[model samples]
Target: MTAKAHADAILNLLRTAPGTPLTVLDGSVPNGTVAPYVLVYFADEDPELPDSRPLDGQSQRYVVRAYVHSVAGNGAMARAVGDRVRSALLDAVPTVAGRVCWPIRREEGRPPERDESTGTVVMDRVDVYRLESVPA
Candidate 1:
């Protein structure tokens, strides 16, 4: 799947998840807006070395970032949102465009912190997936 497709899959997954409080954005939130939300976007992709075994499909390292924010300036809420995101995405092999995206995994996550400029608490998490599809 393409990067856009990957991001869309993630956004859709989070949007439909149960009991998630914040709004989910494809990339960025609107300027001058200060609502609790999470931004999902494609970060980067890298190619993995081809394996020797047959059926060793092309592997790619795809990075997807989730940015959680809360206007209440409550770090706990931000962290809770991040935790929900992590629970939904970790080890998930979500299908995209009718194809199974395999071996998706969470890489790392950051704790909530205050954004000095906006005064909103924010939490960031990064996930890495090994997309078996050939890189475009």
Candidate 2:
């Protein structure tokens, strides 16, 4: 599947999740928008090959950023939002458009930090998955 499809799948998962505060979107949130919210963006895609043979599948990577604003700017709320995002997506093998995206993994994550310009706390998480499109 394409990066946009991967992002959309993750966004849909988060949107339907119970008690999740993330406002998952296909793109970045509007300027001056307040938190708590999340934006799902396509990062990159690489070919997955076990041998030197022609490519059979793809490894897609997506970045999910959770944001929250606080007067203290302590990032506590932002971290909480990040935790929710992680809970919803980490280790999930969600399906998109009837295709299975398996072996989804949390590649990396960043701790919440204060954005000087927006004065909001933000946390970034990266998720990678192997989408097997062809026989092995």
Candidate 3:
């Protein structure tokens, strides 16, 4: 997908960070991998409404899942790839961290949903596109 491609490119760029001693790999994140994702919930964390508590009294942080698998060795290529991918993902989608209520999507599973009464997050969708696959 175009979004994945773009994401991949962005991730690859992060490999250039100074003093990094690992190889940057592109198009290497596993495609058939999947796993559980949970929300790091917070309370009354809305920046605009710091004094207001969510109707449910809980705020959601990081409503996305991270599924990274690789066939490469544990050190160089694999580690670098992981580092860059993690950094890139966080940078490109800052809300993916333990502080934002990103939406969740799935191909064969139930996604998160917002509670109507509480206005708490019910569902979150995190969209990422890998832009390149050229291994470093």
Candidate 4:
């Protein structure tokens, strides 16, 4: 299984998970996308065991961000979405072709912050996860 394949599996899981927010995007956010959505993308990846001759598989890192438009400048909605995302993905094993993915583990998380780039009070909470996989 390749790193990109692992990422795609994770995105698919999030998109279908019942606990996740309604809007789940794979890397790119369409213009005029409503608030209260999730953006998922690959971050970093490395071989699971560099010394292994057969190349076991990959350890991939992915970033999942929950965004919400908060006119109050508060992150309550964003945080809620983040919580749902965490619950939906943490320790969950996703099905990937030619790969056996282990339970997803959270590497780190960041508190929600307001995005000032667009002059809109958009609150986003970021979290990183690690997924290790081996050939099936």
Q: Give the lDDT of residue 6 in candidate 2.
A: 57
Cα displacement (Å) at residue 113, model 1:
1.9
lDDT by residue for model 2 (15-130), tens: 87669345665555677666666666555535444552354434433333322121223467666666676677666767655454564556556665556665555544333333
| Best candidate (score: lDDT) | 4
Q: Model 4, poorest ten-residue lDDT window? A: 63-72
lDDT of 1: 0.57
Give the alpha carbon lDDT tens digit for every residue of 10-106 in model 1: 7777777778455777667788655456765566554454552236554443444443332334667666666677666666666666444554566
Ranked candidates, highest lDDT first: 4, 1, 2, 3
Deviation (Å) of 33 in candidate 4: 1.0
Worst 10 residues of 1 by lDDT: 127-136
82 Cα displacement, candidate 4 (Å): 0.3
Model 3 scores what on Cα lDDT? 0.31
Q: Which stretches in model 3 have alpha-carbon errors above 4 Å? A: 1-53, 56-62, 94-136
Per-model TM against the reference: 0.69, 0.66, 0.26, 0.76
- Model 3 scores a TM of 0.26
Positional deviation of 110 in candidate 1, in angstroms? 1.4
Candidate 4 lDDT score at position 15: 70
RMSD of 1: 4.3
Better candidate by lDDT, 1 or 4 = 4
